[model samples]
Target: MNLNPEQITDYANTFIKVLIDYSPKLISAFIILFAGLYIIRLINRFIRRIMVKRNLDPTLTRFLADILLWVLRIILFVSFISKLGIETSSFVAILGAMGLAVGLSLQGSLSNFAGGMLIILFKPFRVSDTIEAQGVVGTVSEIQIFVTKLVTANNQTIFIPNGSLSNGNIINYSLEKIRRADLTIAISYDTNIKEAKDIITAVLKNNPKILETPAAEVSVKNLTDSAIQIAVRPWANNEDFWGVYADTLQNCKQAFDDAGIIIQPFFKESSKKNNPTEQLE
Candidate 1:
């Protein structure tokens, strides 16, 4: 594999010529790469500042900024590649093909990502807010790019995918300042309805957590063969809703017992009056 002097010289000359021809493009490429990177950093910092100034969610701001940063870097890389005597059209075509393939393979993930973006943008619920979605109700502990973490009353953590969460019905209990607790109280058919309502109304009035502005009310809901159904509605702040609900019921029960209001066992076993859902506004 030995070469004569003439052949070696020819090879050396060719190498030097190629280096001389490409040195400027190579140097320009390096300069452009460094400059582009610096500009990208500045742009990312500026975007972060703007998001902070607008008081955007910290998680969403970081997510969006990182996405923009990578997109800009990819563009800069293409430009740098083209500067070094490379064909950018083919590079772009390859990138497009790769993007399409990756996108297809990650359809569900992309869907979740988009859903996360929507959740962050529209803000159906936020961290520390109580929400019911996809048949699960809990306090939102964290909102991530792909899923939301919920801490249930039982102290269990559940991850709900952003895709389904964004698409499904969401009940945000904390969105409103005030919520109404509805309790269905069942009394014997012979018990005085007006007297029972008055007793429950008194119970609601005495509770500190119940809101006086809305004026809690009790009304006859239905009548059964064995008992009568009474609807007790009390308003409270979101934080006091469950407290108001449980306390009002307990106080009404004690009050009823004192007033000789008979709670029929038949109603207790069958009626779901006490299980009425809380109303949020």
Candidate 2:
């Protein structure tokens, strides 16, 4: 049909009005979509840079940052989708269901992760500290997410579950600045306590390994039928514990014998026959 000039102008204006109304919607959708994705990338990079600058642990910093960035990106994606008239509630429900399924599958790993977090935060022990936990005594080497690594006294590497460590008692020997090295020296009952004590004191003094501040202690701790048990307690730096322990034992024995302090062997019968009062003491 051939339209009049007025009819043609009216049709042209109507088409222009339609385009104008939809142009804003198209632009807004594009801006929300592309800009949201770009912002997510920029934010992820920013978080990584900040974490690195803070000197955060490589593992923890990276893990947390990645999680945060993913959450932000997901939010932006939902916003963008909503701008295009997509329903976010169904997407959120689907994501929640997937997350629940994944979480259930990773239940054991999540337990280890929780246990590791507890260890990191509470700090019951640290790397290189000699600790007794999970029925194992060893030097802690690392506190990884799934396991607690240790180097045994014999230099064997052991990986223990953090769950067991957290539940059990943790005996950390390295935490103490000074450790008491205890030794029980048995001398013949006939030997004078004074002579034995003097001999032990001289041996401790000659070594100079024991701390002078606390002074090496010598006391007659027990009087058995077969022997007089003298308790020798020496204080030494934790680092030199083994050296001081071995040398002090040898020195005490040699010095006592040279001083003519007669020695006696400890017997199970002797301790067993002791009076109830002495046993309790």
- Please tell me which predicted candidate would have the highest lDDT against the true structure: 1
lDDT of 1 at 110: 93
Tens digit of per-residue lDDT, candidate 2, span 1-281: 88999999999999999889877776897898788778778888898899899976555666677678778877877887777677899999999999999999998777888888788767788778888777677888888877889988777889988777777788898999998877777888678888778878888888777899787799988987778888888899999887888788788878876877766878866545532223212
- After superposition, which runs of candidate 2 have C-alpha atoms over 4 Å from their true positions? 1-88, 102-107, 267-281
Query: lDDT, candidate 1, residue 177?
Result: 98
**Model 1: per-residue Cα lDDT over 111-197, one tens digit each:** 999999999999999999999998888899999999999998878899999999999999998999999877787888788888888
Query: What is the Å distance of residue 258 in model 2 from its true position?
Result: 1.5
lDDT value for model 1 = 0.87
CA lDDT, every model vs. true structure: 0.87, 0.80
lDDT of 2: 0.80
